[model samples]
Target: MRSKARTQILFFLAASAGVTMFGMYHVLEALGYIAPPRPFGDSIGTVAFGVDIALGVLALALLPSAIHHDPMEVEYGYVGPPSALVACLVILSVWMVSVLAAPAGAIVLISLSARLSLYWTVPAVCASLMSALVYQLTHSPADPNISWSTVLGSVVLTLVLIAMGSVRGLVLRRQAERAKQAKQARQAQSPQQTQSAG
Candidate 1:
């Protein structure tokens, strides 16, 4: 059970990191630092900034899970119902995969998920669809040569995910070993206890 919890935490952390990187890429785009880039309109740039902060906060929220045994044991309680949780996971998963396909829309998905209101789920879904549509409309023919900064950002993001995964794997392994040892000790003591009782 503990190991299962640890695995969840690790996956959460990796997802958060991936989303944050996606968000940062948007931030950079808004700041006029990258390619296939557009002039930063005030409204969209502000939205992008808000999206970046929201993602960073989401990432920070997972910090407690790193130290605590069970994330659900936290005081605030779980995010929402199992269905909502599943939706968020699905949304996040799709965005993570988008890093390879449509990197532009990754931030949109994270921003939508951060809203977290059950009522907003449908709107968020629609917004994501619209955002992707706009992105595709803007850049239909994909460029083979992406900006160097964008390339560097992707590499860094990949490294962060890789490192987090390694740590999470180690935690799960240790948890399994401990559980196995405890089980073996219990088995070893059972025969002795039985003999003494006899």
Candidate 2:
């Protein structure tokens, strides 16, 4: 249990650091603190962003399992649910992180809420609102008016991702329940067989 806890803490710390660094890199590049790659160009950056989002999704999706001390002890019907205070802290943390890494942070929030059996809509709505707010705040006065279509697209994308994450969480929970049942059945039969043999 100590080892498992240590592993979980280390994994979370590493993931958080990786996401933060990636986010800061993009922010720096945008601010001209870091130069964009000349040869590979923005394509490489796009690919990297996609990969980061993918990894964030995978990590958040598997977070519930990671939190468990033992899968067999999962009695919450799905994944282990966080306390209200923890949930609030998570939401606030994601919101703050999204300011720098919107896509990855938004997806992480959505997946985390879904996996924890919370109202996924809360994070989805929060993500969409945050995206729009960021866009408005960041929009240059010299640039053309804010594009409503882009904002709408972002909202739609957030919703779709939330839906997908929710579905994935549901599937994972069902699988875990099935595995738990099977293990219990085997354990149940073992004692009966031993008694009969004795």
Candidate 3:
């Protein structure tokens, strides 16, 4: 798709997700399920929603550059697709390791891709671990109920997010590769065409 069209679609999706999350935050507050952000009259959480929207918009704006200057496409070919799929597996693995490991190694290594998948998976892993710790500590020390179902569901969510991110990166990478290859072909054929014309 053309850059403008892709930008519009991305912006729309981002706006939709922002609106939904923002609404959920409010609904949680209204139901007294989630405590609001602190301070006399501050709405930090709501502001965070706006920030998310803004970041999405910014990303949509920068999408062209990301496509045009993609390193994975230029240097490694269509690495994005496999990289994206690997990302999902990594997210699930990281979460599991984070929960079970005394000192997690996945988190440290995954940090290298903070710009790709770690940005969200990192926080999800932290939240899951923190939640598990709370649940483990609150119950009888010997008979803690860190429900397997809850952990499984969280792991699944992170895995899905990772997949989505990977696919997105792959799409951009493919575009960059196509552009680069086409540029090279034009350069290669130019000399042959000139020789033939002479």
Candidate 4:
């Protein structure tokens, strides 16, 4: 697949994930105690989605370049310092700001996007937490113990996200490599020779 197409696929995936998150939020809302994680208009949801989609796109764009070439090869990939790393930090910062500053409608925009990193981070944390929960469950008595079902479900979800990230990363890398190879071939072509005999 082309790098651009791979990026588009990832961008689409992130949007779909956002939709899934929204559904979960609604289900929780129906329970009466759950408010929007980041309420739109009043919260950071708008900016969140924007940031998320932006980051995913940016990463997708840059990530492909990085796969086949070194920092020197990928113009976007910086060698001296980790720009993607820094962007992750910025993503988190802006997300917090969006969550605090935006109104309810705008909240959804950046709120979800802001958590883009969490697709990688949150699941790691959640999976670890789930493991601990499971361990505790084993030791506790059946009557007053934590919910095994909930722990197991959360663990399964977390693992799935981790697997998804791995797949996405691999796909992006492969696409990037192919793009790099094609560019190299095009660059390798020598200019046409001109001979004049008088």
* Per-candidate local distance difference test: 0.45, 0.53, 0.45, 0.40
Task: Give the per-residue lDDT of model 2 (tens digit) for 1-198.
Answer: 115776466446646765687678779977999754433456655755564465455544444343333343246653433442243334323432233334334445444545645554574466456646554444332444666777677667666766786786667668778988999999999999999999
Tell me the lDDT of candidate 1.
0.45
- Which parts of model 2 have CA positions greater than 4 angstroms off? 1-73, 77-100, 116-120, 141-145
lDDT of 1 at 35: 50
Each prediction's number of clashing residue pairs:
0, 0, 1, 32
List the pairs of residues colliding in candidate 3. Answer: 84-166
RMSD versus native structure for model 2: 9.1
Best by TM-score: 2
Give a tens-digit lDDT track for model 3, residues 1-198. 225675455445534554465467568876889754343234555564454345334433433333222244335423234443333333333323222221122222232233254444465466545544453443233455566676677556545544655666567558767988999999999999999999
After superposition, the stretches of candidate 3 with alpha carbons farther than 4 Å from their true spots are 1-16, 28-73, 77-148
TM-scores, one per candidate: 0.37, 0.52, 0.41, 0.36
lDDT of 2 at 83: 49
When sorted by lDDT, best at the front, the candidate numbers are 2, 3, 1, 4
Candidate 4, residues 1-198: lDDT per residue as tens digits?
Answer: 225675455445544554465455446655756643322343354454454445434433343222221334233342223343343333332221222111211212222222234443553344345444633443233335676676566555445544554565455557667988898877665332222221
Best-to-worst order by TM-score is 2, 3, 1, 4
